[model samples]
Target: MSDQPANLREQALEEAALWFASLQDEQVSEQERQAWQKWLAESVWHREAWAKVEQIDREFHQLPTQRSFQALQSAGRSRRQFLYGLAGAAVALPFAWHQRDILQAAWTPGTLHQTAVGERRQLALADGSQLWLNTNTLITVDERAARRQLFLLHGELYLQSAPETQALRINTDYGSVDMMNTELNIRLGNNSAHLAVTTGEARVQLAQDTTPVTVAKKESLAFNQTRSVLTEGISANDEAWRKGYLVAENMRLEDFLKALGRYHSQGWLKCSDAVANLRLIGHYPIADTRKVLDTLAQSLPVKVRHITPWFTLIEDNRNISHS
Candidate 1:
């Protein structure tokens, strides 16, 4: 019985390893990529095994390119059978042992602070600043004798700078925000960063432009790699996420669900186009997503279906009936 469980684990690892190797090919088709993703999403065990295989392979790259290729070839009779063969274990073990230092350094403290999916965290900096991290956020704090800096690698953060003598700044790939005893909210999106000032003021300097634009209280700015645009009359509801609530005012259903999905750890919330434009106004708690979905079903002309733990679909009820 114990051997049966071991055999299952080995089978899963072998399959994951095959997928990992196949994906490395430059000639891999889109259909093959989709199938691989489906396999990865089907089970947690498969994901974990694939992650380990990827890590081992990455470590293999540190060796001489020609030697690494030879090693991989020798591990299996053919490239496709590389991970399943007996030599696979032999090839992977040495790289794993050699890369321990690299893996440990990657996760060193003070270099990175991250909030898990569906998790929030609050931190008090040494300079008395308050930092609140939203779901799936990663940030790094660098405090120097001359200046204090923060880099938002991804996700959102609300920062309240304490009254301090040092100059404080927050940086993203798009731009940087200079703060002086300021309270602000910044969310990093694809290719852009959204900045809203709650109190005091912030100066935003985009990557392409040298001149910093000043944003005052109740103001917001959206900047990409090339430019920054400032807007007045920032909504109070924008900061509602700090209090663990999502406040939407006649917001499109698709947009609302996308915002709500940030706080959810389970399946993605997907809405059909038939009801995507439906407007909703409400303050929903971010903590209880199941209840939020139930509320949506009650208030809107839509039916929520849980296809899987990782996929929830919202379809127009009227269309469903007609069909």
Candidate 2:
């Protein structure tokens, strides 16, 4: 009775692992499919654990060799096998042999890296690529000679991918995108992924579908989890967030706040409905969201209120008499 929570957590993680494995199996049933989807959207902890499993799945799919891929596929835990590893070793030996030793050698524990109430971090990858982890970001990378991949599990990342021997790809929960000599960035919301290409050309292919659409430089695309339709837009400052600032020229207040919230750990930035239509044209820093918020409040006809450590509300302040 005392260990039920721990058991449930472990069970939840195992269920996530099974979900990914089932994706690679052709005979997966509709019930199993719906079950996995339900678990994913069940709770924050469930989603986090599922993300860790997907992180590993992306790594497995991006490996340079088939042996590594097979190993990962075999190491996948089953509800029965996880609980009876010792007893099932004999029964699972043949499958394990086919899986290879990649899983054992490259087992990476899951970790959640997040920004504090107001913090940001610049990350440098081993391949010389750079990542600007947005506030409250939880990302994981699986780099290999044959493939370069990133899982923008939540939040956002300003990615400046370095040249690679092979193609580079960024896999999200919804789909996978491929890049070529380009600077691409991704922002993950509830069930959507917004992608912007700052420089060079690239292509994005939805996972459920095969054909990919080419995106020229300075193009942006948005993808919803359940829909294959991609919404397209244009932004000159596609990579501006990487420069520690977001440049907006006559952007709407609501849109600007949405972008600003990406760099905030508190993840709450709301513009009053009264001032939502206000036009904003300025540069907001990504490194320090507080500075940006302060600058906006002082420069605009609004009052910034800290509702909580991580939540902020911007409202109209029209009480200044003609004194």
Candidate 3:
């Protein structure tokens, strides 16, 4: 409903983002919020921007906190010196370029930051830690005065803990991971969690047992409600996904499709039994599932049957008997 020109809308949106971020910060003062109202009353565009930013939050699931946005703005969104009228220009942001409209979630307390299917997001927390959220992930972060805590509710994440707080703790339903200047990957399944520590060490405590378990560098552990298995070999594939690729190292074809299905934009993706055990070896980009499916058909004796955007079935190309 905002008829403001694109440029004004963009500027309004930027300021709205700053206000949204500012309001959610526990450090925000009443005076600053009152100042936001003054700026809001200055123009219709400002109100529209605020509304738009709120709408974005409704869709995206979480807004970037100060720590989250500060680093992200430094990464992909080009920055320029911008002074805020809110807080009487007390805040400064390196906001000079147009940012993607979708990252507008305002980080509020206890909110879950999520990524849609087929989408990956990298977040830079205020504590200097970095987090890359895999597709269809849900996680919550709590950075209070004394320490920082992360909750991995579902899906996968690759995190490099900030040196400032090696004591940061991450909680999943299965247990908690206490980082010691760590770089790690975690994925939560229906009844289990898989953790891989690439560098540094972590102390894990499962829900069923208060006993702490140590996972050293290069070690991978998968645990459920009752048991845990410490193994190896995740060093390669897990790291590859952080770089936007799904690497299949002689992985089974059905398993490969299972991994790819996590990033499928819609519907179900499956392979027929005939090609279920076919071994696949390749590193395919995950940004486009359709492209990956097409590539899969080209590389092996498989036929990709894309009935619609929502239905995909891969069958044996060599079998000419069935439809």
Candidate 4:
């Protein structure tokens, strides 16, 4: 919205990136460091771009080096190359930080159990209950004399409680769900939490509501800190991700891609406006997202464009067909 041209802004970022790269070298001269400082002080845009680059570097430094290097390696890139690309392309630092935070939390030793991206794990509790963790999930189990509690830091998990005198509770930022002898799935979304009761019953106590809402068997509820609970029917295939497949029934292309992206470690999936609203119905394997995209392109009026190993775009095939 400002008067700055896109190309100019990109150029400024690139210039700032060069200075950063230069400073990283052990043989950098005093004159070069002075030049970089002078350039950084010359213009506001240059300073702003350098600040963002520094922020990205700071976040990366906070993460475990091996994990960060592995993520870059999977994308066929190095850390320096990725940082330069981020600067030139103006990648969102906050989003990168968020992903790092998820990975960091998953690696935290405090949690009794955790799962990495595209990895599902099963555990047998001491009380004969079972727990299944979905991709990028972090949960800590607390078994006290009175109750069994789980704190879901991120992602989704399916729980089957054993028959016990004490109740089971799952806690998140938005609220908590209390259950006993119940089979349920809990997913932590960006702004809300989803609780689906596959068997038995559970009660959700949202932070905003004074009274708790009871979720019956075969019912799904989504609630946030500010909104009332929205309930819907749960199909048998709702928990199919536990079996390594995502069952989509007339789901929007954008929504489907977002769900699929969670299992993919390479990069993000983006749908162009021309195809974002298109509906899809199918069971896609969570194991191989590239294959799923290829299959989707064959079935739907869309085309998959791989911009990079880390970025894919889905566009309407009608335009390509006409062209």
Clashes of each: 1, 1, 4, 0
How many clashes does the backbone of model 2 have?
A: 1
Per-residue lDDT tens digits of candidate 1, residues 1-323?
22436556666666665465445555557778888888889887687678766665555556565555434322222222333432236356424533542354355323667775567899988878899998767787777535678888767899988885466888787988899989999988756889999999999989888888999999999999788889997775568877889998999998888788777665346676678899998899888888999999999999887643334667687644211
Top-TM-score structure, candidate number: 4
How high a TM-score does candidate 3 get? 0.64
Each model's lDDT comes to 0.72, 0.60, 0.68, 0.72
Displacement of the residue 100 alpha carbon in candidate 2, Å:
28
lDDT of 4 at 276: 76
Q: How do the residues 1-323 of candidate 2 rate in per-residue lDDT, one tens digit apiece?
A: 23447667666665554455444445546776777777678776677667665554454346455444233233322233332322224224525633333243234323334443235578877778877875555565777535766666556777777775356777776788887667777776555787877778778777666667677676777876445444456564556655667898998887888766655644246665667788888777777778888988888888776643323667666631111
Which regions of candidate 2 deviate over 4 angstroms?
1-118, 225-233, 307-311, 319-323
List ranges where model 3 is wrong by over 4 Å: 1-111, 320-323
Per-residue lDDT tens digits of candidate 3, residues 1-323?
A: 33556566557766676566546545556778778989899998788778765664443234334433332322221111221212121112223211211233234334568876678899998878899998767777878636678877657899998785648888877888889689999988756899999998888888888678888899999987567888865557678887889988899987888778777664446566678899988788989878988888888898776543333567777752211
User: Clash pairs of candidate 3?
Assistant: 63-105, 63-106, 63-107, 67-126
* Each prediction's TM-score versus the true structure: 0.66, 0.56, 0.64, 0.68
Ranking by TM-score: 4, 1, 3, 2
N/CA/C clash count, model 3: 4
**Predicted structure 2: lDDT:** 0.60
- Badly placed stretches (over 4 Å) of model 1 are 1-110, 321-323
